[model samples]
Target: MYSTHLSPMQTYLVSENLKKMVSEDWRREKLHSNIAYFKTKMKNANRTVMPSGSAIQPIWIGDEKVALSVSEQLKQKGIWLTAIRYPTVAKGAARLRLTLTTDHTHDDIDFLVKSLVECTYD
Candidate 1:
């Protein structure tokens, strides 16, 4: 997964817009809320760490619709999805490893996690 570190200036810009531009403020507020939601979900997801330096977010592929949809969406957004399959991952240990980046908004990550959960559960 990718690492995200917000620079002070960037944080200030967002905070300022939250106080200035109405549209930008709304977007920023939504993103912040979404990030909080996703972070909570991730903490509960019981992700696994593989020997290959990859992180496996506890996703059950027996239900593929949610995960697949999220993966496709991520690929479309230039976020690569590295799926661990049967041959590559041990039995009953498949998952989606998302590499996060600084370029990604918190909203992007939230949407992704939400999409995965929706697809897997539905």
Candidate 2:
């Protein structure tokens, strides 16, 4: 009878997590705080951040190769950022998609921005 086929335990865990997130105002406050923190860190690193109030932050690198290379370097550093390129977006608009989460710490975000600056700016 379950359309999604989730087990009862699965449903319970999911519901509990959702309730916790809602009770803590995850959407209105936490997401905003994370985004703001990310934006500030990126800006402090001399990176221009497009206004984004969401969890996903797309940082434009402009060149396909640069974006791919940076992404590879980040991967080697134990980060899992992805490079976005043509077909998914217009040419010359290559970018790295950074996903911020409630689980990310300030140190985590700082390290990411620092790594990106080293990869792209230096």
Q: How many clashing residue pairs appear in each of the predictions shown?
A: 3, 0
Q: What is candidate 2's lDDT per residue for 37-118, written digit by digit as tens?
A: 9998988888866567678899978889988998999998899998888867799888888878878888899889888887
Q: List the residue pairs that clash in candidate 1.
A: 2-99, 2-100, 66-119
Candidate 2: Cα lDDT at 11? 93
How many angstroms is residue 47 displaced in model 1 relative to the true structure, after the best TM-score fit?
Answer: 8.2
Per-candidate Cα lDDT values, in order, are 0.53, 0.82
Root-mean-square deviation of every model: 10.7, 5.9
State in Å the error of residue 13, model 2.
12
| Per-prediction TM-score | 0.41, 0.78
- Model 1 agreement with the true structure over 1-122: per-residue lDDT tens digits: 44335789999998896576555555556545554444566656643223232222334453344446656665775667755545555665556665443345666776666555444233
Model 2 gets an lDDT of: 0.82
For model 1 the TM-score comes to: 0.41
